[model samples]
Target: MRPSIKILEEDMKEKVVLEAMEILEEIGFFVENTEAVEILRNAGINVDSETQRALIPADLVKKSLKTAPQSISLYNRDGDFVTVLGGDNICFDPGSAALNVLDQETNEIRTAVTKDFVDFTKVVDQLEHIQAQSTAITCSDVPEKISDRYRLLIALIFSKKPIVTGTFVKESFEVMKDMLVAVRGSEEELRRKPLAIFDACPSPPLKWSDLTCQSIIDCAKYGIPSEFVSMPMTGATAPVTILGSIVQHAAETLAGLVITQIVSPGAPVIWGGSPAAFDMRKGTMYLASVDTILMDLGYVEIGKYLNLPTHAYLGMSDAKILDTQAGFETGMGSLLAGIKGVNMISGAGMMNFESTQSIQKVVIDNEIAGMTYKFVKGITQRDEPIAKNLLKEFDKKTHLLSHDHTMKWFREELYLPSTVVDRSTNEEWITKGRKSIGERANETVTKLLSKYPGVSLDNDIIEDLTRIMKYENVDFKTKLDL
Candidate 1:
């Protein structure tokens, strides 16, 4: 069932736009890189060479933003299962795993390998609620070409919905192209139906690092939707003020959008960002709060103002590891923001500033996503209509609990908890061995990873993928222990 979206009002959006412009022009942005300073200055912004800042007037910023294509279309192999870039699909992705979270069964934290990644993908395939599978885990098996090789392995394993991925190297971009050609069967087919990759940009102003920017442009040329993530860290990376952060994030996103549009006119793209403030108390960013959640949502508003499909970080927490703090923060933030109709809310089951990943937390987050979906559904009105004719419909003193209608809709109305939770009294709880929620979640993840079977591409397709890997100059899969 699709959730009804509540779009921001036109006037309200315009107000945000006007305010963003004012902030960009008046407040400007603090930039340190002289090369980046030159880029903005050459673009005609008023650059303070001594301060190394770019004070873009509202008109220029608005004009720069106008360079973006309003909407994007993401397609898969066979050009099948294409979803429009915008609207209320509300996609969820796994947490970024440049680092690892606690592994309960292992009794200690460990770096992720290719086996770990394949296991994660297998579990994600079974989740009816998780619409898109992100290229989340880092592959230690093929160290040299991880960016290229893992994407191939995942594509080989799962043939589900569209994938949200990004490439860190030049060959990885070509490796992506090879996988697209293999899955899509032809360059024409792949071109017709492309994937969406998250092109990340360092924030506080619009500046692209060497390899990442080039890779994103390559994807754009091939018609892949590039979801630009402008990660603006408050205090350290960006200004401390939330409003100032918004302007800087906007500028960064708009700049990337322009470059993508230039690479491929009207190519599919997203104005996505997840900029959060630094918690002085904890000294960590991505803190969950009304401010944190709303700030991200508010940026989505600014993005959608351009009539573009938007993405924002949600379902993530500042919790150090998997525990109560993680669960509640995940539940509250994802629950509320999903209710607000955030499209492509990622950071689900992620912790420790998205560097750390947890499978247990992902399961818990799945529960939270399910609950949020239910909350936003509001309530059905079957009883309201039937109540008007209650006397005529039922005999006096009859128990409506046993009515035939009760059996039909009861299941639909209730959100039964998954294995991660318990719905019982003290007596029932004692009888069940009283395992901890985290422990139970660990068992569930192990079970899913063990029992679940994922899609397998043809042998010829696998060979082609391997050949592409050789071209990628990465370690051979046969030699790797993974």
Candidate 2:
């Protein structure tokens, strides 16, 4: 049997969902977008024109849930099927929208530039365990107006994996969609095989900004998957209790779902969030806190209970550096998320409360992801008689090292991590210069970049991408030659 975890009981999940529907019916959500207001007004829901408060009835929410797809299929840039974001199938990608990167040479956090993002994309492309790439960081070198689509452009040029990306402004979505269409050759094909999932976050305490609401609607109209990232900080923007925060998250996510399904009856959406456990002493929000991880797992359970694809900001650290705290927190969160089988597990290279990205931490997290994948496979009975036949063959004089059984199962049973992980003896370590994990990861990063067979897109496609970006912002200067 596959290993799994569920924090919310069956009855509790029902209760949580019911409370969320009731909250939407009674308290309502503040919908800032005029188009979204009209959509709700046409859907026969009560909308206050002055306040822009959309009172979505429970029946509408239930109907929206019925229309929203349970699974979303994501494809690589080359139009090949990659993975599905539903059920117990889990996929990992680096977190999105980090402002800073841990500089390997200086070992200090600094603003990320185009080069930093390119190197990050290269590393993510080679990681065996990470299934997708993200617009992981914003480029300081580029103009902020085009930053959202600019990141997507770079990912399209360098990596072949499907991206987990989003927009900062309402107008950016059309340009971003045009870029994806350029890669896929047409709008219909791009919609048929979605190349990316856009993240649309709802403001806390039942609020959807005009930009995010527009993003949700645009994604729905184009048949692109929209991931609802509901961030509710405990004891701060949301209620102090974990269950209370989850109720708020459910309400906010349901509101987005209603808007998406209303726009396009069969549009895809994932039930995802990045909720935080507030530390009152320092007034800091901890992404890696046990409380926060529990909240993520709880909401994922609720999503599963609702039979929807789920996502969470787990497998990341809040620590300032890649120290013991980083390892402990990243390992715990990743293993738990893997065990729970969250569909799209984000936050592989993220740190410092998800404000920073570390390529080295990403290299190490690849191994963690590998191990977690193995752990969730559980113990398999490889032989017919279980261990009896193998045990019968064991003798004092003859060990299993030279046996055929060992040769057959060792490779599959054991998860041999990359050289980034140190398993050498003390004497071997001394001979090999005793490099730290960060140092080892840095070396791996160098090796991967050196051997990276650069993606070769047709000249016409390259010109099209560049033309799209240049059209958006005439002054946009890129580190890429194109």
* Best of the candidates, TM-score: 2
Writing each residue's lDDT as its tens digit, candidate 2 over 1-482 gives 89977798899999999999999999999999999999999999999988889898899999999998999999998899999989999999998999999997888999999899988998899999999999999999888988999899889998999999999988899899999999998989988999999999999989999999999999999999999999999999999999999999999999999999999999999999999999999989999999999999999998988889999999899998889999999999999999999999999999999999999999999999999899999988888888887787666536789888889999999999999999999999999998999999999999999988886777789888888877544543345754
lDDT of 1 by residue, 1-482 (tens): 43444445667667667765666577665555444445556666676767655566766655545665665566654456656556554666665544564554663567766666666677766665666677767766566556554655564445465677777665677777777678778777676766545556544555555565665567667777778788777776777776666656776676555445545566667878777777788776765655677668767877766777788777877776677888887887787667666667787767776776677777777778888877777777777675666556565646668767767787788887786787778788788888777777788888887777544556677677667667456554454322
Badly placed stretches (over 4 Å) of model 1 are: 1-79, 148-152, 155-159, 383-386, 390-398, 471-482
* Residue 353 shift from truth in candidate 1, angstroms: 1.8
Q: Residue 120 of candidate 1: its Cα lDDT? A: 68
Which residue pairs show backbone clashes in model 2? none
Relative to the true structure, candidate 1 reaches a TM of: 0.84
